[model samples]
Target: MSIENPQPLSINSMAALVTLGKFLEEDQWFPQLLENKRIYRVTYSGKNGQFVCFAQIMNKTSIIMCMEETYESKVQW
Candidate 1:
């Protein structure tokens, strides 16, 4: 049996998600929050892993973003 090399792909995918989160905030790309009521969660998946990019738009020029990932081999977040 041939072992699958999935680490590189998973890691790359994780990095991309993180980059996306940063991009969402860079240059004030996100739209202004409508009275504390604007949030978005983006999900991405690879061969053996998946991740989420979470961002909250606070106001016209205020936003926060965070990324989280999980792999098939990992037991915890």
Candidate 2:
């Protein structure tokens, strides 16, 4: 059956949205993936470990860089 209305976001989903909004606004992390790729994938490392995120080529213009990550050890890139 087709539904006319959609369900509201769960509490966890809402929290994720807010967290992602803050992350995108304040985090300046991006990966230098394969050459000529339209999308870039990056991993963010924190005290809790690493998580993955990505951005599209067209979205680069609107992305804001609030901070850059510093590693205690040397990284490949």
Candidate 3:
């Protein structure tokens, strides 16, 4: 779950990125385009709960990630 980029990321952020990459690579996620930006969506059910994630790679520099747990959890972006 480690990113080989210069940007710093927290442990949880790294894990999320790894999950996003895996889903994308496996062609298991949906991609949307908005204002010429490509956003990826990953949705699945985990042991803890149902999870949905949105990730947008911005300017090839940083990632904007959002996740919502469908188990009485607040959304994080």
Tell me, by lDDT, which candidate is best: 3
Task: Report the candidate with higher TM-score, 2 versus 3.
Answer: 3
The stretch of ten residues in a row with the least summed lDDT in candidate 2 is 57-66
lDDT of each: 0.48, 0.47, 0.55
Query: What clash pairs does model 2 have?
Result: none
Ordered by TM-score, highest first, the candidates read 3, 1, 2
> lDDT by residue for model 1 over 1-77, one digit each (tens)?
11232222245444544564577568445533233234456555656466665555322333445576454587443
Off by over 4 Å in 1: 1-36, 69-77
**How much is the lDDT of residue 20 in candidate 2?**
54
Give all candidate RMSDs, comma-separated.
17.8, 13.1, 10.5
Can you tell me which runs of candidate 3 are displaced by over 4 Å? 1-23, 27-37, 69-77
lDDT of 2 by residue, 1-77 (tens): 11233344456654554555456556665444434333345667766456565543222132323245546674443
TM-score of candidate 2 against the unseen true structure: 0.30
Residue 57 displacement (Å), model 2: 2.4
TM-scores for every candidate against the unseen true structure: 0.33, 0.30, 0.42
